[model samples]
Target: MIYIVLSIFCSVTVAMLLKLAKRYQISIIQAVTINYLTVIVLSLLFFKPDFKVINSSAPWPIYIVLSVLLPTIFLFLAASVKHLGIVKTDIAQRLSLFIPILAAYFIFKEDFNQLKFIGLGIAFLAIILTFLRKTEAQSKSNKWLYPIMVFIGFGVIDILFKQIALHKELPYTTSLFVVFCLSFLVSIIIVATMVIRKKTKIQLVNVGCGLILGVFNFGNILFYLKAHKALASNPSTVFASMNLGVIVVGTLIGIIVFKEKLSKLNYLGIALAVCAVILITLSQLNAV
Candidate 1:
């Protein structure tokens, strides 16, 4: 329970940091690059992953894909927050759970009970309602592309992480280290290219923000993994709790701290999202 709470706090903190970054006019790319560097350092110091275990037969392909996708999605997340506000962006991110659930039904042919099906239905409706805006100008200006990409990107990343978890040859921590290293390397190349093109200048402020972001970012992942380990047999509980916790907490923070405005329909969508999570959780309990 403590692990779950810590994970939720870390997750929300990362979103909050990104929101603050936008306000401070920090460069997202530079911050993300430095964040990856911090992640690599922390991963090495804590996990101490053995590099020699990595062989030709290792899951390099998945690692490579994740390495590329992680930072890319993170950038999209920042953009989503900047354009769509934290409330909608957070909701869209939490809704990504639907992607893996749908994949299980189709690809893995997992059994879906009535509760799960109904929950999925409500989740779909919730997404539409959550993103719906009243004014035409607001709708036109706040492009849906960023949040849409975040939803899909995070979902795909989740699926890939699950695949990595299934592989027993290498430790999850080691795999994480490899992914971070690759991601950092890729970031270095991107930053170099930007420098050459004179697109942006690197500043210490961005690096400082990235360092703080990195701590919470890694904390979110680490504590979530710990919660999973603590509740090994109840993965669904962790999954539902984490997603719902983020939505509930993030919504409150956005409204209270940032003074983000939402229509009544959006609030109703949030209610439906809660129901969807509850139903999904119940379905998991029933399966167990």
Candidate 2:
């Protein structure tokens, strides 16, 4: 439970940090690039990942895909927080679990119980209502695209990570290190390209922001793994708590601290999102 709580905190904190980045004039791309560097260092220090086990036959395609996707989605994550606020962005991210669940049904051909079908129905409604802007002017700006991209980007990334998990020959931690290192390289290419184009500048503040963001980002992953380890017998509990906890915590912080406004329908959407997660969890437990 402690690990789950900590993991939730770390997850929301990443969004909060991105919210703060703009106020401090931090460059998200640079910070994200540096964030990958921070993860690599921590992975080496903590996981002590053995490189010798990696071979040519390893799932390099998945590794390369994730390497590109991780940092790219992170930028969209920042944009989503910047434009849509943490409330919608966090919900979109958590709801992305449905993507893998959908894959289970279609690609993996896992049977879904009635509870899951109901949950998916409500989740779709939640997404529509959650992103509804109160004003026509706000709606016209199309900033909603950020969270939409977040939804798809994270969904795809989730699918890829699950694919990586399927390859048992490589340890998850080693695979993590390799992906992070490659992501770092990919981020460098992006940052370098932007630098050459003079679209953004490198600064010490971005590095500092990245350092903090990396700690929280890595903490989210670390504590999530720890929570799973601690509750190996009740995997469903960790999954439920982690997702529901983020939505609940992120909602409160976004509204209370940031004073983010929400329409009544939006509030309804959030409530429905909670229900959707509960139903989905119940569905999974029944399957077990």
Question: lDDT score of model 2?
Answer: 0.93
lDDT of 2 at 159: 93
Model 1 has an lDDT value of 0.90
TM-score of each: 0.97, 0.98
Query: Model 1 off-target regions past 4 Å?
Result: none
Model-by-model lDDT, in order? 0.90, 0.93
Badly placed stretches (over 4 Å) of model 2 are none
Highest TM-score, which number? 2
Error of 2 at 28 (Å): 0.3
The lDDT leader among the candidates is 2
Q: Count the backbone clashes (under 3 Å) in each candidate.
A: 0, 0
- Error at 44, model 2, angstroms: 0.8
